[model samples]
Each structure stands twice: as structure tokens, then as C-alpha cells.
Target: MRFLLLILLFCFQSIQLSAQTNNYSISFDNAVHHEAVISATFKDISTDTLTLRMSRTSPGRYALHEFAKNVYNFTAFDSKGNSLKITRENPYEWKVSGHDGQVNIKYTLFANRGDGTYSQIDETHAHLNIPATFMYAPTLNERPIDVNFSIREDLGWKVATQLPHVKGNTYSAPNLYYFMDSPTELSNHKVREINIDGQTVKFALHDPGTEDEADTYFEKVKKVVIAEKEVFGALPKFDYGLYTFLACYIPNASGDGMEHRNSTILTSTRTLANGGMEGNIGTVSHEFFHSWNVERIRPKTLEPFNFEEANMSGELWFAEGFTSYYTNLILCRVGLISPEKYVEGLTGTFNYVWNSPARQFFNPIEMSYQAPFVDAATSVDPVNRENTFISYYSYGSVLGLALDLSLREKGLNLDDYMKHVWKTYGKTEKPYTIENLNQSLNQYAGEEFGHNFFNNYIHKSDMPKYNELFSSVGIVLSQDDNAAYFGAAVSITDDLNGKIQSNTKIGSPAYKAGLDKDDVITSINGKPFPNGIQFEAFVKKFKPNDMLSVTYLSDGQEKNTEVILESDPSYAISLQEKNGDKLSKKVLKERKDWLKIE
Candidate 1:
């Protein structure tokens, strides 16, 4: 009898604690000026002072955004309508005292940037990324969150979000983490949904295009969803048995894609009738893959993502890069792109990782650690990233390609390996370490193969035998030995002087000759090049081991130097038939199986 009473008492107390909900209401009457009036009400306060803050970082992002910089017109009130004392505790935080058991706080948010990272409000629509639009009390993080949007019905607006709908214009989140992850979009957009395995997948597209264009785009989105589902064997069990693609392809939106627990934010400035029909689908393939890879098969370093500071992780190579490797491959598998185009498309990323000097300083693991500084981070001073960094996305994608081909050589495949990982870590929602991935590969393949791969390519930054691997599948990895390489892009000014566009590559002939960005090339080989086209044509005249006298103006001073030209260190991937190489029966079968083509 005593034990039953104790259990009942605990259950009753739990309900009471959860009932202390955080209520928020936002009205966009002043949305024409790119502003929103947001208010938060906290009830059942038990402390002498409550600390509230705007998030410095958001999920799926590594850098600090300083979201508090957009907040102004702050005020607070008690239940009796008396003003409460508020003080600035820090750049992102406010401390409120002299409040009764209940307090309401209001502020005006100036949001104009429309991307996955920030909020935007205007006469057209209100695109809200939760971290950039809302503030919360750290002490009340465990309480339920309720948000009401006074939407502009005059503009035929509708609310679309991953948040569970409570009633008209109201949404609810179980806790702060889920609330922060749910971004909402209010606009007059078109929506399409498909039911798969007892779950509904929705595509809410806010684009100014014809209905036919919207239908065509949604069909492509469906193919992407199904293709990615095949990789992981099934769709993730979404939180509410639903998943949404909240895409804003409008002129005012910035290009970005961010993955959340149950939805993804896809924003771009290209509409469906424009180049977005092809340009934006790659982001779709990349972010949907994250539904399984990073959202659930999470890195331990990013688990319980911090909102007060930057979040760093060393697993983004696999988290981001492996997904990148599959991005276009999925498109090919679904017949959206031809197999030849997919194979040829590998050339750009392959050459980028193969020829970068940054690999000498950091392996894939160390490169993953640079996310906080390079991932959407902003800085005023110039950086030497040309010599120090390679995007983990590109690096990891090529690595994933290598591993996939290597595993196929052993009568296994990456699909099975990913399924094993999904069952072990992703489905269970268990955070993983790099060692976990190593062990997963060991179990899927063998200890010897796994150890060799991680030790050489991942830990030590050694180049893979890509030529031999490509040959096994009847693909050619070839480079021109006689192509001239100047290794610096130059733009011709209206005066016909060639101007360097960016930092010169570290070991290129241009860098060796002391050429840098903003340098104007007045004369080359003792001749003044008339235009950029002519300058490029002139450089093609020299072969490797040739020398030329170059003159340029750097920082308003004329300079002269001798540059030794080298052959272009770029590789191309193509089908054996395209290169006129005979494909043996075994190689033909291997290629067919690799590309799933008949």
C-alpha cells in the first residue's frame, strides 16, 4: 500500500512540473519593415531571478552566430502588469528580477536574411529559423513550449513546420531542444505529400512558379526521398510519423540547406522555372541523407549540442562527406541523371582532394576539427585557407568513394555497411565515436581491411590507389601530361590588364613566382596581353619545364619575376568505352554492378 502511494505521488508531481509551460506569441503586423513582435510568458517561476538568452549556435551549424544582435525593444512584465527589473547579463543573456510567480517578456526581432541559419520577415512572407527568432529561459528548458503565430491571413499565408500542431496557428514542442530544431515558414505556397510505410512525407515549396513547374519539382523530390531511403533500408521513424521538406525558393532567400530531426530547411534564390530545376536538387539529396547519417547516427562530440558557444566535431567527414558522395550518386540511381554524367561528374571532387596541399597539414580527422572556423563562419581579415584547408565535404566524399569501391572489390558494398551502421547506432539513437565507425567497418569487412583504411587514409592522410580502383570498375583516371598550368585565375579589367582573382595555389607556378590576389598583370613574356581570353590563350603556348618573364603591379608597385611552368595536375574520370579502351567481360560486369545499369 505504501509503495503504490509513493508511485502515485511521483506521477502527480511529474504532471505538475511539466505543466509549467513556456508560452510564446508572435505577430508580424510590422513585417513590411522586416520586423516581428515576439513575446514569451513563463509561469510558476520558483527563483528570485530568471536568466533568458538567445542562442549563439544552432543545430547542424558549427559557428557562433550572435543571434542576440537582432533583438531590440525589450520589455518585461509581471502578471499584475507591473514592470520587472531587467539587466544585461552578457551579450546573449538577460537577467530578470523583481518578478512575481509569472512573468511575460517581449522583444522586437529585426530579421531580414532568409536562410537556414537566420529569420526573415517582409511583406512577401515570414521565414523563421527558431534559434534566430525566439529566446528562452535556461532554467525552464524542461518545460513544454507553446508558440502562437498571428499570421497575415490577408496575404493567404499558412503555417508549415515540423512542430506538432495544437490548434489554429498554434504549435507545441515537448522540450527546448525540439522547439529550437523546428523552423517554421509562413507563406502562400504549394504543398505535396506522399505516404510511404505508414508515414507521410511532405514537400512545402514556396516558389513563384507555375503549377506544372511545382509538380515537376515535387516529383523529383519524391525520387530523391525514395533513393535515399534505399541506402539506409528504410526511412527513419520520424518523431510524429511525418517528415517535411520546407523549401523556400524565392528571390529574397539565400542558398542553404539544414537538416533537423524530422524536417529540413531548403532555401535558395532560384525558382523552379529558373536554374533551380537542376541546381537545387543537389541540396535536397545532401540534406535528406543527413536524416539517417548525422541526425540519428550522431557524433558523440555533437551530442547534446550546445547553444551558448560553438559546437565542434571531428566526424563531419563521414557525417557530411559520405553524404556528399551519395548526393549525386542517388540522383543517378534514381534515373534522374544519366550514368555517364554521374561518372564524369566525379572529376571535379576527385581532382580537388587529390591535388590539394592542405592534406599535408591535416588528415581527414584533423580537417573535420576545423569546422568551427570554416563552416559558415565569417571573418574580416584575410585567410590563408588556400594552403591550409580542404572542405571536409569534398574530402570525405572522395574518401567514401574510395571505401565503396574498395569494399566492392571484396564482394561487399557500402549499402550493406550503412545498413549495419543504421541498425547498430542510428536506429538506437546511440551517439558514436570514430572508433565506433572503425569497428563497424571491421565487423562489416574485416579487421585487416578496416585498420588499413583508417590508418592510412583517415588518420595519416595518404592518397588512395584511385587509378587502380577505377580500373577495376572499367573507368579511366587519366591526366594530360602536356596541358599548361598557370594555377591562378585572372580577371581582365575594362583597361585590358589581367587582375588576379584569388590567392594563388600554394605550390603552383604563379605562387612560386610571388604572384598573389589583387596583383595586376601588365605584361607576360615581355608582351602586354590584351584581355583575359588572350592571356589564357597565351599561357597555353608553353609546356611543362618552360620559363617566362612576368611583370605585374602589386600594391601599386611594379614587380618582375621569372615563372617556371608545370603540367596541370588534374585527373579525369570517364568510362572505358569513352576513352576507346577495351572493357573485358569481368570489368564490364563489375561496372554494370557498380552503377546498377543494364
Candidate 2:
């Protein structure tokens, strides 16, 4: 028995030593045309046929984006440089056979979009989102991976990525998941770094702006990193003791922010010298907060994220929403935005979530499940999203606000609760479920408190008493009682008529009056509408409870209706002082503690 055990151990060690690494190389010979030549070499193959596929989904995204459509000129070869047989398995996959224990495949990749989920290779830079640029074998997913980038030195391009560097222009990943999560940017960019709590955080700015602008913007990035670190009580134990921010703030880049295990991609068309200095920092705050929230304090449903299909999770409310709540709040805490600006900015999202009829259809959990349909998804069919769906981002953000203020009423705060969660799950790198979140809250703030909060908000669509909650912190939630409401968005047409641009809200006056998208309003109050003015100004002439004879064209048919105007349902939140209300000592203390004001 002892001899047999030793022989088996020796055989396992031999197999491990013979395991192969998937090697890839990318070059931009036709970067001017937004094309990249990529090749992958697989060695020591155990199967007679190997399957290669491009990922249909990307990290931090919930939708399927057919990456295979961008690949062309695909060819396979054996070790002797002889051509091999290739078979089409599907639109996303190809099968190669008759390889002599090795296969080398080359393909042309056409990438022009510059965002978090897509790859862009142009004369300015190569912003490569890994999954959108590479093809991998599902069978050898456990094997180590290596990539070498042949950068264009004439363009002064340098590589910025989260993948651990093995040598010059080459990087390695432990497995397929990590490689896909690593997006690379090769540009003539400036880099700024800081060491926090013994871990290094870097910001690589790819922009056409001055060095001073880059320096000013990187200061905000540093402050965001530090503020978010304080929320989780510490930075995540980054692989290789490093975290990177790959930022592309240029004229052609699309605005997006995506979080990964060790880094994030920040792309925007707004340059730092122009509006982006303040405009882009909000995204910076949001994505860095995700380093602790979704990346490490992960959701079990998103564990081992699927590359071939949309990855959905019911916990995006807490994962994405809570981070969103802190997105602006952290900026306020870090002095990027004033406390008044932060509080006042709440009005837009507050009205969006509070007044939305979508709450009648789905709870926060169910809203989170709608991610695949709405998270950067594309479709031509018209759907009633305005009436039936609320973004999980807004829904969760408001809930996080409610929960925070509710906890403060009980002499606790959300920061400590988040710290407890981070220690239990994020620091331990443990994937969690919704019940686990409830359990964690129960452990921190008693069972009854947790149960009621989750039951009322998470499991059901019941709204919290936000009016009283805001009052506790000396914030005023007020609405205009006399403002007339028009629920459908209207645009002025070229022929000087009001065109309804979207579906009216379910319970609004416009909906009750049968007004809908594409209806051209010809006259109001039995008089032809005067041209050369905005639609909003035209609507402002009427007051609440006023009756009007509205005539419009629906399906090119003239129709007239009696519409009774109702008061606007929108609400605004503001500081007590801003509203001429004195803050009591108790309310003042609560407000100070909540906003971390001096």
C-alpha cells in the first residue's frame, strides 16, 4: 500500500509539471484603421481537438456583447508551421484539429469602441478590454496564461494594466478569469501613484491635456481612494500589493466606469481641462467604492462570472446601489463637493425613485434582477420601462439612504455596519447572499431591526418614511403644491409644434388624458400654441387644477381631449438653513455626524 501511494504522488507531480500555459501576443500594425493582429499558442495539448472562443460577456457588465463579430482572418497551425483543419462550432467558437501536441492560432480583431466593456485600437491609443480582444479555450481554463504586447513606440505608448508584470511588455495571469478581468491601456499617458497603508494605488491618466491638469485630476483620484478605504476600514489586500485606475479622458472615449479585482477602467470624452475635472470625479468615487463592494464583498450569484452569457445577481442593489449612495456622499466627505450641493443633488434621484410607479411592479431585489435587460443593453422594440421598471442603482441608493438615516435614528450608522460586512465577507474574500447580508445586519444591529428593514424594503416595495427621516437630520423634503404637472417629455419640432417624446407616466395627468409618445400637440386651451418658445415654458403658463382643451395628432389623426392639470409629484431635499429653518441642537448633531461635517 505504501509503494502504491508513493507511485501515485509521483505521477500527479509529473502531470503538474507537464501542464501547458496559454500564450498570447497582440500587435497593432493597422492601428490607424482600428485593427489589432492577435495570436494565441497552446502547447502540450491532451485532446485531439481544441475549442477556442471569444467571450460574449465582460466583467462588471450584465449583458451579452457578441465579441466574436469583431474577429476575422482566423487561421490555425501546427508546430511545424503547416496549416491545420478548422471547423466552425458556433458564431463565437472555432474547433481546431490534427495538431502535433501544439496549436498556434492567429486572428484579426477590429475594435473601435472605447469604453469599459469594449476594445479600441487607434492611432491615439490601444484601450483593450481583455475579453473583447482575446479568444480562450474553455477546456484549459485552469492553465496559467501569459500575454506579450508589442506596443507602438513611435506613438510613445506605454502599458497600464492590473495583470502582474513578468518582464517588459509581458504579463501573466493565474487563470482565465483573472486575465479576462484585466483590461489593458497602452497610451502616452501620465501615471501618478500613492502608497496607502503599505499598499500602492496608481492612477494612469490617458488624456491630451497638460501635466498640470493631470496632476490636479490625480489629486481628486487620490482623495477618492483614501475616502473609500476609510469606509471599509482598510484597502483590499490587492494582488501584488497594487491597485490601478486606467483612465481615458479624451475626445473619442465613451464615458464609463467598470470595476475589476485589482483595477478599474474609467473612460470619458470630457477632458480634465474642460469640465471633466469635476465631472469625472463622481465616476472615480463610484468605481473605487466597488473595489470593496462587488469585487471582494462579492455576490454568490455572480461567483465564477459566466463569460458565455449575461451574469445576473439579485444583490446589485446592495453591491451597486450602496456604492452609488456613497458615490456623491464620499465626494462631499472628501470636500470635492459642498455638503449643500450633495444634499440638493439628492432631489433628482429622490424624485426619480420615490415618484416612480415601477415600485408597484417590482421590489428592490426584483429590480436588481432586471440588470441584463437594461444595463447597457440594446433593443429596438419600445417597452414601458418608465412605468414598470426602476433602475436598481436609484432604487438601492434611496434605500441605502433610508437605511442609513433609519439606523441613525436607532443611534447607529451605516458606516460601521459596512465595516462589519467588510470584515466578515470582503476581507475574507467570501461570496455572500441576500440572507447573509440580513444575517450580518442582524448580528450588528439586532434581529428585529434587520428583519423589519429587509422585509419592508428588500423583500417588498414598501417605502420608508423619508419625510420624517430627513427631518431627523434637519433636511427639508418639500414640494411645490401649485406647479402644474406634465408627465411626458416634450420636444419642439422643426415645424414649431410640441411633440411628446416618451410614454407618459402611469398615473400622471398626461396619461389619464390619453397623451402618449409621438403625439404632436397642436393647440391648448382651444387656442393654437404660439411657436418660438420652449415646451416647458408653454406648460408653465397653466396652474394646478386648471382645465384645458388639448388637441394633438396621434397616429396622424386629430384628437381633442379635456385634461385637468395636477400638481407636480416631484420633491426636493435641502438643508434646513437653506430653507430658513433653524436646526435644533439634536438635529444639528445628527446632521453633522451623518455628513461628517466640521
- lDDT per residue (tens digit) for residues 175-215 in model 1: 99999999999999899999999999999999999889989
| Candidate 2 residue pairs that clash | none
- Tell me, what's the RMSD of every candidate? 2.0, 2.5
Worst 10 residues of 2 by lDDT: 13-22
Kindly list the per-residue Cα lDDT of model 2 for residues 176-293, writing each as its tens digit. Answer: 9999999999999999999998999999999889999888888888888888888878899999999999999999999999999899999999999888999999999999999999
Best by lDDT: 2
Residue 579 deviation, candidate 2, in Å? 1.8
* Per-candidate clash tally: 0, 0
Q: How many residue pairs clash in model 2?
A: 0
